[model samples]
Target: MTPPLAVDIDGTLTRQDKSIDPRVFDVLRAWADEAPVIIATGKAFPYPVGLCEFLGIPLRAIAENGGVVYVEEAGEVVYNGDPDAAWAVAEAFEQEGYDLGWGPADMVNRWRETEVAVSLDRPGDRLRELAAREGQEVVDTGYAYHVKSPSVNKGTGLVSAADGLGLDPEEFVAVGDSENDAEVFTVAGESFAVANADEHARAAADHVLDASFADGFLAVAESFGIATQ
Candidate 1:
């Protein structure tokens, strides 16, 4: 079987500002021709899917941390999964007054809608302050903020996507740099942490890469013996 290459977007493949080098996509385009190189991110439906298209690579994607899974069969996304478990876990955090945030899957078409919010669970102190100021009801999940949707998170989302793809967790390899990426690390056969990863995420990852985004991505990809253009 062709091993699956699951890569993170925000702080892994792209820069911290989320910009992609043209060559990155070019490399991805080449890799896609060889195997299933998927984008696994905490982002939601449209953007993640769009990124794959922009890269000119139509491999499978585990988006919103796994809340949504997409596989391009013909020309567009053809598979999806819900974050039921994520909802439950998020709810637990909300009940604890932890100020939870839902990912992009919860807001699909309404990404621009003000009523929807995404929350960040890390940088614990910052999150706590935001929770207090935003009334525990207003915090950005790197997308938007809404109180009720706190039950959403990335790790569980990735699991749902893994299941939907019918790929064994052991066949997948995830790379990330934050708290949200914890689950992907757990499920993947191998996991990597970039040098700039937050403490929690770095601790959770199976291996720590020597470089940061756009800086070390090629080296890390090569470590997996992946062919890069």
Candidate 2:
């Protein structure tokens, strides 16, 4: 059977410059034809939902790095972890005289409902401390550091999505390129990391691809005999 595919966005589906690779549209759409193509990422809610809409795939996503799971087919929008963790972190940053590193009118976390994403350019150690104080953990997703509850992650989101789809989370194949995707690697039946994957993601992946970014994802699809072309 064609197993479900759970994929990350920023470093998995995007190019090196962080732009969403249009080349992946057909490949992911093909995977969706066989089974669900789950867009799992640290990105905000609308990002993946918009991708699904354009890719013509099921509007299923594990957003906020696992803090939120949206299964459109099941009409289920599940919110996990500490709902106020993001806000708490924001408040803490204010107390610490930090600007969240985002300029005024930050749009990054504007639509975020659960977790907080800190710019990688900021002070990671300090943000981690604040997150820990808020009963949250900081996950490095290559592009940014996510401040979120430790309990909810891509792994748990996959389980919830599977339950809604009547599939098994362990039967799914996960692919990503950063630390936030580690738990998903553990939960999936098989895990893959792109050539550009970070140490945490590479260590967690069952297969490390030769290609990077969208090319790596195409390699994964081809490995499963799901031809993208």
Candidate 3:
């Protein structure tokens, strides 16, 4: 069997407005019918799981930038790091008046299981400094800054999920459009970055698409000879 396709959710699968393109959804649904389609994203577990529910697809998801994995067959989420450690770091930042919140806009400071996401406006350098001091890891997802453990990331989470499913890492393709996705690009045998991807992400990818968002994802699927119908 072809290895599953792991894709980032926000900028790669949806538009800036957080809306899924109908055409893209159509292709995704069709693709899911033939092979596993894993949702790899920086969002919390529920967010991507919610998307899968909305699409009526029984696909697994990697959330919190690899901090959590939701295995569809298991119907449970597996956490990669210590949630208390992440919260401790968040608390320390909060005491410093950092105004830490979950994500951007309405989702700001949303609660997560294994990681904490703060609005991107916060100083990235400070966050990194603090994380280093606490022996933690920080990654910018373009939408938010996530604090997690060094052991976990999109790459590790993707590998964990694929291994659990008995899929070969080299058979999978990863697609994304942000700095946090750089690690994912490194782990997958084939990686693609959308036109809107950050320079770092593009550099890490095996292919860079001219189109943005879902269009770019569709282009990637076509290039891999994956049927969109």
Candidate 4:
């Protein structure tokens, strides 16, 4: 039987700017044609759709952690778990005095130099600083400060997406680079951490890429017995 593969986008398949190395597509397309390829990521928008188109596969995608699972066959989205409470909590904090900004996909992101105080009146810039200082505090997808539902994370999303496809979660191999990807790595049959990944990501991965992004992805695909070198 063909194995299921769960892949991360940022810092694993693409560069910091989200640029994909030409070779990434070559390997990915080949692999997708060989097996079912599922994209598990924090991006909640239509971005994953482009990837599905690129791969020429019609599986499912888990976006915004596990908050939204998009099934291609059904052409619809399902919420794996409710993040209403988490959203309310984040909004309450924002109202109370936090400088939190909402991310594109509703995730929370803080800066690396601000204090860790959750206040409603906090300035947006200051909140970014706080996120930076907190480093791993839930941050937004891009430059926003939206916090995702506490229970909604990538790992949970992966499981949900896998189940939706009627595949064993343990049959997947994942690759990622941030705190959000930690659980995915732990849950996957094989996990790869890119060279530029954070400390937590590296620790959870079964292998570390000597190269970053495209190079790393190519190396990983080769390691998995995929067609790309």
Candidate 5:
């Protein structure tokens, strides 16, 4: 069997408008027929789940950067860190005059069970310092910052998801477009980065595609000879 393909959702699968291009969904549906397409994303748990449901695909998801994992039939499992601690850190940051903006009212927030995701204008280094002092981690998703336990990350979540599916971590392929995806590149047997990916992501990936977003993902599938139709 072909190894599962682990993909980041935000910038890797969505277009500039932050919407899933229909073509991308088409490719994903095709890829799903060949192998599991596990979504490893920094978004909240429900976001990816909703997307999969809308696409009518039963893919697994790693949400909150790696704090939570959800299998199609197995429900959600907390993979790392304490949600209380993460929320406390977010509160502390808020009290310190750092504007920690929760996502839209409909989406997940610090009150969620796995991670505290907040939008901030503060410097990334400062956030890192605060997180480190609290034994937590700060992940910059380019669109938002996430606070979670230091032990959890995209790589860890992917491993757990793969194992749950009876797949080996070494048999998975990871693809993403940001620094948070660095650990995933290290853990997967092979990794790819879109052309628009950050320097850190590009350096970590085994191959960098000339395309961006869903097109980049399709390029990867074609290279691996994974049928898209």
Candidate 6:
């Protein structure tokens, strides 16, 4: 049987500009035929849902770095993080004269529900301190600094999502490229880190591919006899 997948977006399927590698679309669709292909990312809600639509996959997503999990086929939406706690951290950042740093519009986090995303340009150490003061934790996703509850993470989200899908979380294979992806490495039956993965993620993974980005995803799929590298 083909294995299910929990995959990260940015730095895994996307380029530096954040555009997805088109080659992955066909590959993911093929994988979806046999098992679920979950788009798990630090990106806000609509993104993963929208990508699911575009990818023509009913399996769906784990968005906001595991703060939100949408199992479209199961029609279940799970919220693992505390939105109030995230808001408190965001408020604390503003009080300390540190904006979310996404400019006036801040579209990066506009649709976010359970976590506050801060730009990498801000002082991470200071942000961590502020989040800690609010009884929250700050996680660096390699894309941004996310202030959220310490309890909720990709691993927990995967467990919830898997239950909704009527599958064992340990049966899934995970692929990612950063610090935020580390927890998922533990829950998955196997984990692969792209060559471009963060140091933390690399250490957490069972396999580290020589290829980077979408190519690395193909490598993982290929190793499973599912797709071409």
Q: Positional deviation of 223 in candidate 5, in angstroms? A: 1.9
- Over all chains combined, what TM-score does candidate 6 have? 0.96
Q: Once superposed on the true structure, which residue ranges of model 6 sit more than 4 Å away at CA?
A: none
- Give the top-scoring candidate (lDDT): 6
Q: What TM-score does prediction 1 earn?
A: 0.66
Question: Which regions of candidate 2 deviate over 4 angstroms?
Answer: none
State the lDDT of candidate 1 residue by residue for 136-190, as single tens digits: 3233334333232233345554555556566666677677776666657777788
Reference-based lDDT, residue 131, model 6:
80
> What lDDT score belongs to each candidate, Candidate 1 first?
0.58, 0.87, 0.82, 0.64, 0.80, 0.89
At residue 153, candidate 1 shows an lDDT of 43
Local lDDT at 138 for model 1:
32
Assess candidate 5 and give its TM-score to the true structure.
0.90
Cα lDDT tens digits, model 5, 117-146, are 777566667777777778888877777778
Single out the weakest 10-residue window by summed lDDT for candidate 2. 94-103
Q: How close is candidate 2 to the true structure, as a TM-score?
A: 0.96
RMSD of each: 6.9, 1.2, 2.3, 6.6, 2.2, 1.2
Against the hidden reference, what TM-scores do the models get? 0.66, 0.96, 0.90, 0.74, 0.90, 0.96
Cand. 4 Cα-lDDT? 0.64
In angstroms, the error of model 4 at 154 is 1.7
Error of 1 at 32 (Å): 2.2
Off by over 4 Å in 4: 73-76, 81-83, 86-146
Ranking by TM-score: 6, 2, 3, 5, 4, 1
